[model samples]
Target: MAASLTLHPDRALPLDREQRAVAREIYGQTAHLPLICMHGHVEAEVLASNTAFADPARLLVTPDHYVTRMLVSQGIAPETLGVRRVDGGPTETDSRAIWKTFCANWKLYRGTPSRYWLEHELVEVFGVDQVPSAESADALYDRISERIAEPGFRPQQLLDTFNIELISTTDPAGSDLAHHAGLARQGLGERVVPTFRPDAVVHLDRPSWRDDVAALAKVSGTGTGDYAGFLDALRERRAAFAAAGGLATDHGHLLADTTPLEPAEAAAIYDQALAGTVTADQAARFAAHMLYVFAGMSCDDGLVMQIHPGVLRDHHAGIAAKHGPDVGFDIPFAAEFTTALRPMLQTYGHDPRFRAILFTLDETVYSRELAPLAGAYPSLRLGAPWWFLDTPGGMQRFRETAVDTAGFYNTSGFVDDTRAFASIPARHDLSRRVDAGFLARLVLEHRLNLDEATETAVDLAYNLPKIAYQRRI
Candidate 1:
């Protein structure tokens, strides 16, 4: 007999009886509250079309780097998992075979946060009764296939069912946002929104930088033949995103450097880049300067700025060359923020309209740099544990290291920054549970009363992201 798939109600609560009881009370207060997913990678077209998901593997496995990365690490080929190759190489087109392979290797995810999320998606989201294993793979796949085919399982309908009060999809700076307009026609515009991401055009070292800049010029109706025109084009695109209900800008620079450049030097570097003669040092300086420019723009327009740096994206050239980017070989390195962001913060850290949420992959800086920096800056709030650091233990560690210095309010609430649509609730639920445990410890330690903990729990789970992203209700 297959192991029955069951989710314990008190899965992540504190182990001690008294603390567990307190955590239970705190979790209950916000467990079913509406989700405010202010930052993620879900495409607007997915919800705008309101189409039924294609299949279990395509919906769950193929698009999620978190899952694919682990499977690849364990000797499973990406092609066998149905991940397409850029060279049009052969891959497993059979979704059922991919599902079976995933199940056979399910044990590889033991003790991982991915396990928690997958189990939640199975039991709670799709109503699966048996745990996924080699014996149960086909049955689970067919069950999920049938469920997704149901009319009520459409993405837009699931948004209501998931209680997502608001969700933001990351879009290129030059996007026309036609899908966003379609969502508006369906009355989902206010709830399903867009976020401006200009990395492709802002980073001078990319191979396609010239082409992206050209596209940006065409979309913004502003020339990018010079530094001034490029900045103008970016500003125009920002305005268009804001008009379409965007509230934040996302930047994923390799470093957190925010030094401004002299106008003449910046212009010369821009000309060199346009002429395909810019050196690596000049490119790095130009990228750093753009961060400062983006911050000033945010201060002027009231769009919250989100910076997540220190990721060495596409660690393996062979995989990246074959699969293109985001097939999950990214690695994180140490990051220095205090010195790196000094110039920008010194200029706008106190600006009333400027709000920057900072994320890091380097946990060592949480207490030493990020906590102190966020604790002091009026314009800065530490974003939740991101990317590789969004695990259960990582979330708990963030509170332990950050709360004493930065406090709860100085930190933005949880963001389910995922491309797997079915994993959003699982991610949020994990965050809420970890937070409840942390707050319960505080309550027991006499640092906070139960009433205070309850209110703060609600804020962390629902209210903080809304306020951080400048969303009302």
Candidate 2:
């Protein structure tokens, strides 16, 4: 069966061998270009310490819910896969057992992107080719576990091996950039920096909002019990992030909705939020005002603002109650970006001095809502298809809808937008192949020339992200 299989180029309509060969050639040309990862949520300390990866399962499987969720969907238990419980309850201690559990369920990922990424990591990264099923799990685990103990497998070494030019990680508002500063003190050649993400402190409706705000005050030396002092602490943290090479701010909100509320009304609501007396509507208003406040700060601080909205994060109440956030329970919801952002958009949307990149999990917004907004607004640029919409089908649908109006330049190019380091190159490689295959179709249809398509491919893969994030930071 393995000998009978032929590799296929990523596409909407599949292509024949000649087309696949051309796709491979195009992909080969740009495969080694330095990676420009403008957005992600990796812990900065792991890279700063430059440690060799732990056992393969811990480094690769536990952090990436993409793999865990797929395996879980096939009836594998999260606890068995080493997913941590929010209540501090532990899982199986044996890492090899976790690998066996995953390997036994590997068939669930067949014909899925996870399968592609995993298989590539096996053959290209670990030099193992046999498909990872129950029969081969032990051999694969032992080999990778041994390789993980090598110096060449250190995080920094992998960065160099992957040719990553600049990487940014998300940190909460109160986090001191001590680790990032340490990395800078070491004088690493490539840039690895923080991006300010204030969700914990800003989302006052969260059950732990008061505690989060108190933490912010503790870190930044400002009184966060009041609105004015809380904002002051946040601004100070932003300055620290900038000094430590932060170039941007990232927002994960339920909606792209933003508005400015009357100061007196906002202050009263903030008091209630601090006292844990806010209602659902009050929570939405509070989040909206905070987003607007961040927008104003970005105008002053010169940080590129990124908003990823339309996610009903932790939709599974049981999972959220047990395992906390980003536990594969975050699902796509309908969004109203054009109207939702009108209040903030009207005020700052025309300002060339301001820059905000908008991302949505709601695919229906791509053409109807997002493209027109990005096409018209001076402050807004459409972010790459993200989260649920970050698939081959998702990317294809995005280009089809957004490019016709906003064109490629108005878009911010490809971002793997993943926390999985083992899968990063595979993610980027998948994007490049998809782009090349799309361009090959364009050339065949006479919609674009080979030269223009080639240039576009390079920009999508390399130049645009560097320029976009650089121009702001």
Candidate 3:
């Protein structure tokens, strides 16, 4: 018999009787507050098109690295999960087969955040009564297919269903943002926005760097033959994004280093990169220098600068070569923010117009580095626990470690940095519950009064993200 799935009212709350009561109260206050998703990877076209999702497997399994990575670790092939190969090799073509593969291996996701989110999507979003299992896989798939085919299941409609006040999509630096323009025509521009991400052109080491630069030049109407024009092009694109209702820019780098190179030195390296003569060291230095330049640009444009460093992207050479990037091969390394960020922070830390949100996969720096840096720098705010650290336990540890130094306001609220649009509310809901439990403990300890805890819960769930991302600035 298939186990009946249920969502407990007090799921993710404190275990202690006294604290659980307080947590339930705290969670109730903000459970229905509209989500403010300041950073995410959901493509803007998904909302703009308002098309019904193609199928259950493609929507739920193939694109979610969290789900795919676990299956891969268990020796299941990516192709079996319907993740297409870069070489145009054959993968599972039948969406039903892919759904069965994921459902059969459901045990692999136990105790994982993916499990929590997936279960939430199944129960709350799709109204599935049976937990995913080999026996229930076909029924669940058909049920989900029928649900998605309904008119209300379209992406745009789900935004209202999810109670999302606003959601930002990460747009490449060279993107013309036609989807954003389309949404604007429909008067949905403010509710669905773009965030400028320039990593492709800025990171000179990428194999397609030159091509990306050419694209950026074309879109921004600037020449990329010189370093000066490159900077101007980036500035122009940032302005374009801001005009599209963008409130922030996203940066994902291997390290947090933000040292500035002299103008002559920077131009020389840029020339080297253009000529294809730049060494790895030169490329690294140039990427670091761009961070400094971008900081200055933020001060001028008022677009909040969000940097989440310390990810070693595409750790597996084989997987990357086969599946392309963001297939869950990214790994975290030790992060040094105090020293690595000093150069940029010193220049913009006190600037009223400059705002930066920092995230790290390295939890060791929560109190030691990130909290201290955000606490002192008026322009700095700690981003929500990101990537691998966005789990429930991670969210709890983040509040405990960073709040003591940075306080609740200095930390941005939850940003469901997800490619899976259906998982957004689940991610935010988990963060809220974890935060409620954490705050409940504080109240039980008399560290915060009930009124204060309730207010802070609301801030962490909604208000802080708007303030941190300059959405309300």
1-473: candidate 3 lDDT, tens digit per residue: 88999999888888999999999999999999999998888999999999999999999999999999999998999989888899999999999999999999999999999999999999999999998988999999999999999999999999999999999999999999999999999889999999999999999979999999999999999999999999999999999999999999999988888999999999999999999998999999999999999999998889998898888899999999999998988989997889999999888899898999998899999999999988999999999999899898999999989999999989888888999999999999999999999999999999999999999999999998988887424
TM-score of every model versus the real structure: 0.99, 0.95, 0.99
Which window of 10 residues has the lowest lDDT sum in candidate 3?
Answer: 464-473
lDDT of 3 at 11: 86
Tens-digit lDDT track of model 1 for 1-473: 99999999998888999999999999999899999998799999999999999999999888988898899998899999999999999999999999898888888889889999999999999999998899999999999999999999999999988999999999998898999999999998899999999999878878989999999999999999999999999999998988899999999999999999998899999999999998989999999999999999998788899999999999999999999988999999998999999999999998888999999999999999999999999899999999888899999999999998999999889988899999999999999999999999999999999999999999999989988889211
Please, what are the lDDT tens digits per residue for candidate 2 over residues 1-473? 22212233443233766556555666666777888888877678888898887787887687788888887777777888888998889886688888887877877877777777777677667777566767787887888987778889888788887778888989988787778887888885238889999999878789888888888898898987778888899999999888888888999998877987888888889999877798889889889988998888988888889999888888889988888888787778888887788988888887766888889888888899889988988788888888767777777788889988888888888877888877777777778877777777777778888778888888989987766665352
Which residue runs of candidate 2 sit more than 4 Å off their true CA positions? 1-22, 471-473
Comparing 1 and 2 by lDDT, which wins?
1
- lDDT order, best first, reads 1, 3, 2
Residue 145, model 1: lDDT of: 97
What is the lDDT, from 0 to 100, of the residue 405 in candidate 3?
Answer: 96
Per-residue error (Å), model 3, residue 431: 0.8
